[model samples]
Target: MGAPESLSLLNPARHAGGVFVNGEWQRPRGGSRVVTEPATGLELAASAVANAEDMREAIAQAHAAQRAWAATNPRERAAVLLRAAEGLQAHFDELALAIARETGGILAKGQHEVREAIVICQIAAGLPLQAQGQVLPATPGRLSIARRVPHGVIGVISPFNFPLILGIRSVAPALALGNAVVLKPDTRTPVTGGAIMAEIFQRAGLPSGLLQMLPGDAEAGEALVTDSRVPMIAFTGSPAVGRRIGELAGRHLKKVSLELGGANNLVILDDADLDAAASAAAFGAWFHQGQICMASNRVLVHEKIADALKARLVAKAGYLPVGDGASGQVALGPMIDNKQLQRFNALVHETVAQGATLEAGGSHTGLCYQPTVLSGVKPGMRSFDDEPFGPLVNLVTFSTDDEAVALANNSQGGLSAAVISHDVGRALALGERLNAGMVHINDQTVNDECTNPFGGPGLGGNGSAVGGPADIDEYTRWQWLTVKAALPAFPF
Candidate 1:
């Protein structure tokens, strides 16, 4: 297909009027907020900043809509999601362009994200039937079955990176399971998220208020989560924010799923292919400017291959084309905003001050930070301990499998890890010992499959996304149903 026509930039106030609530497009009572493109600092769109009243109204609508939707059979709900997926695919190009422009992701990457969103929607559509529970043996003349049920109104707060895909992935599963959703897209890239979801739901004939999109900042998100009407919350963002949300949800005794930040690690074994490993590491470290929650931030190479891997990894980083995300050939995009850029720069400088050598690409152009590699990195450096959340990777060398495994496990954040090794036995053994939620053998650890569970343990945070069946299961609660024959008249 040819490139999709770009969306005409609209004034933030005017765009904010499009926020969907109660089956109608309307503006927030508190007014609107402007969204700017990270790459050019151009105003991309404006979104309605929802207030306390808006949150209440949305919650009420969701509660009412969720009851009706939950009453609808799973088969019908599945059909709606399937239809939504089809609609998304039909308009992939349009959706992709909006995402690229709004989120500062390369056009190709945006297109891929759009496609992935469709896939997630399609997979989630099948969740209705797949959510079937088991029939357990019971007493004589009694039948007991455990079934999964939705958590009424669910609140979803998505991050700026992978806005389209992650939002859809979370929302689709919740909607498919017969729960109403209140989505708060990231303040920086709300246009693409709100637009794509509005388009798909409009086509799917979804009930009014079943899926509401409120695009704004932290205040808006706080309003949604703390509101008593919302029974469940799904958040993907920084750990600090996730912790706050968790604390709030805990007070209410509400259910919450959080996919927080990561300082993901990658181990390069002595037997690995230096060229391929370097290339994969570069991509894994720099994709989406390393804004991804699961982006590999630390590299542990066997001393035998450390020098060769570092040389090739640095060289590969230099080849990454960085520029306007709208440019099709650009592989690296700018950070989401100036704040993120500054934070990234600070981490790099701090790591260097701590004795880490800058291997390549530490310069910045506006929100764009060059794909950077730092060697001789030791523990205690900011980049080594904290998630850079930018295009930065720290490299260190290990002497043995035990030491490498120890180093990998040293981080409090155990989100995900990649081990590049030719020896399958050793890889498997290491995988078993590693404490991450997922491990990739001979590959970078950014692999996200719709059917596989995604999320990390410990400080990486607890919660999973898009693990096909696991996602469906996570969004629902189980109830046991027992049917028993009447007692004998004598007993009565």
Candidate 2:
């Protein structure tokens, strides 16, 4: 017989009890909210809705625990992250199932995100040695050294798109830097996030209050970002909310890192391989139901190949399957909610009315909008200017390399862009001219290594999120130490 009902992964009992704070699982001050699967509309779990008071209490706990955590040696901090990574790997299947059900991500995609989280934790564990400062030598018998230090306590506000990955990406580095953390996950997907992270940290032996999960609405988020006890803020969400958080952090003179939304562009040069370009564009546009911040929103193809490219793109988009997230054969799933589906449909209707042609897929069912492709789109249209954070791609034609580059840089957002061309020199030149923080040559801008500094410019965010040594360096600050060998005379 199949596994017993109690032994099945879908049973809610396998999930964590509720949000965790001060090393304990507890309910919110008031009512609760149910977390549901987007694709099937099934209730996955329920979590307490933390409010302002809960946020304040959690911050106080974090502030109290931060002192001792900061005092702990870097080696010990790294050990905690390492242990967390081990625990995450050990419980990978359970975490993946939770993510799949909660986010409606396809089974394979959900599993991949969980693996990525494990890698992020492992990388974070190395921050103890990686965060070491520089040694400067000025003269003999004199020593000057710069050391990276934690920012006391940090507040992290994560979005729902890649709940676990985004949370770990920011929280891991913060914890590794020895700063206590107060994490406020988006209300919609808090169950998976709370369950996965709390278990890992607990298994890693993290000190009480060093890390806490607070799940609630905008009020809770506001409390965390504005709290005086939290010295730093790391946020991932829309530009509107990011601006508000930045303003608050600015008022308090606190450090802040925000990874906001994007209306990213992908340029297809005349010389690009049609087959490869078509494939990459399809993957970049529809991956994760186009919920990714780096998803290619606009495709600027050279006029010479625009028609051919459009045909191929339409064919590819038409074939994407939409079904329950648990199905192995499912490639694309539903949007997070009905509101997003309506917004996407309205954008398509508006774009078509403005003269853009619907090249493929525009059907909808509940929360799922079919993978859509539109052509003859221009800057004046909403699809060209706004971020269609659903599975939609707008195709626009350009005449020359310069025009392609110009069109790609026209948007106020500059998170990421890709240039697909076989010519090395041309691709490099275009890469230099694009206004995005990241420009990929002959490749899609979807994959990012944790070591790379990842963030965007213009409307994207103020600082980088992941990439290079400099990327991870944003997680810390610096302090200088000086010593005098001889006593100096004091004068009043």
Candidate 3:
């Protein structure tokens, strides 16, 4: 049996309901939005929605708190992050269940996200210790040095897909660099993702007002972004919105980081192992219903093995279980909402009309779209350039390696690409020609590590890196200093 659709049907108080401001929960000034269980259309909770006033208060609180937070010892701040990781592990089951309910995520996926979230916390904890600086080599009777410092208040706007992981990754890194965060999580799953982080940080003994979680729709995000108090923004969503943010933040000469979705692709060379390639495709194309920004929009296969790869993918997609996430028995779960499901179906229909043949599931029963595979996909098709961001994936064949690389690079840069080949030399050489911020060899496109420099070129948003020890550079500002004991002759 699956879990009930509504938290009201269970222990209502357990839902971490309300907006988090100044290290505390507050009633929304603009009312609340119903958070529905996508798998069943059941009301999970009424997440508090923030209005302009609420957003202002949160930003003000964050700005005020940032000073104290920056003044605190970096090592002590790191200690808090490490403790928060342990606390997250202790509440792992509860967090996983909340993630499944909030996002309609399959149990295994919810568990996987929680595990990734914890790892992000752990990595963030160690980052503060690795902050680096350099001393200048050329100077007489003087000292010259450069060091990184916090960017003060930062506004983090995260999307619904993998909310817990995405939300925390942004928040943890900013905090590690001694900055305060005013986070606006996707309204759909705020409590499970945003509010939960506030809870853990509070329990971890983080200072009050250091981090605020505001749960609301796009209006709230806009208010947070356009505000002058927030000098920086870290956004993860579509390129359209990222452009708007870039324009606004640029107007103010403010710093911003974006991780927008892209039309990603992968290539399968003829010599690759059939079963291994097939498994990689299934995982990359269908995990979390293919909502990842790095999910494959199209796959280029060597013509020699195209037929075999297509058959394997069809068998895998056709055999995969699909149902409500709470059942813990299905491999695939529901789309976030009906609109995405509609788009998924429309894209498939249009692609088929454009001459691609459907080899597996393409329709839907409510929000649960059957994993779909389409062959003979061409560049001009709606499905070719459009990133459906669902379980639907396309297969296109290439006769030569140059053609495959061309197809992969054909997109207007945003995400990543993968090259699967038995020849390491060939794979590495081909990877060099791909246009992306990240590339994988003999691997899938849908991949991330907590300590990697993740983000891409094109419309994927630039000017920041949100992962690894390198994150200190993005979340903080750098200053060069020079000191002289006495006046020296001017060379100017």
RMSD in Å for candidate 3, one decimal? Answer: 3.2
Question: What is candidate 3's lDDT per residue for 1-492, written digit by digit as tens?
Answer: 232344221234543357888876778797887789998898888777888899999999889889988888879999999988877777777778778877877987788877888898888888778745788875678899887878899999888888988889889988987899998988888876687788888888889998998887778888888899888999998888889888888988789898887767788999999999999988888888988888877788999999999999999988899889877988889999888788778989989988999999988888988999999998889888877789977998999989988887777785778989999899899988988878899999988888898888876567356788558878888888888898888999
Backbone clash total, candidate 2: 10
Q: Return the lDDT, model 3, position 140.
A: 78
Best lDDT among the predictions, by candidate number? 3
lDDT of 1 at 37: 78
Candidate 3 Cα errors over 4 Å, as ranges: 1-17, 485-492
- State each model's CA lDDT, in order: 0.81, 0.81, 0.84
TM-score of 1: 0.94
State the displacement of the C-alpha of residue 475, model 2, in Å, after optimal TM-score superposition: 2.2
| Candidate 2 Cα errors over 4 Å, as ranges | 1-17, 137-143
Please list the residue runs of candidate 1 whose C-alpha ends up more than 4 Å from where it truly belongs after superposition.
2-17, 463-466, 485-492
Clashes of each: 5, 10, 0
At residue 228, candidate 1 shows an lDDT of 82
Score every model by TM-score. 0.94, 0.94, 0.94
Clashing pairs in 2: 451-467, 451-468, 452-466, 452-467, 452-468, 453-466, 453-467, 453-468, 454-465, 454-466
lDDT of 2: 0.81
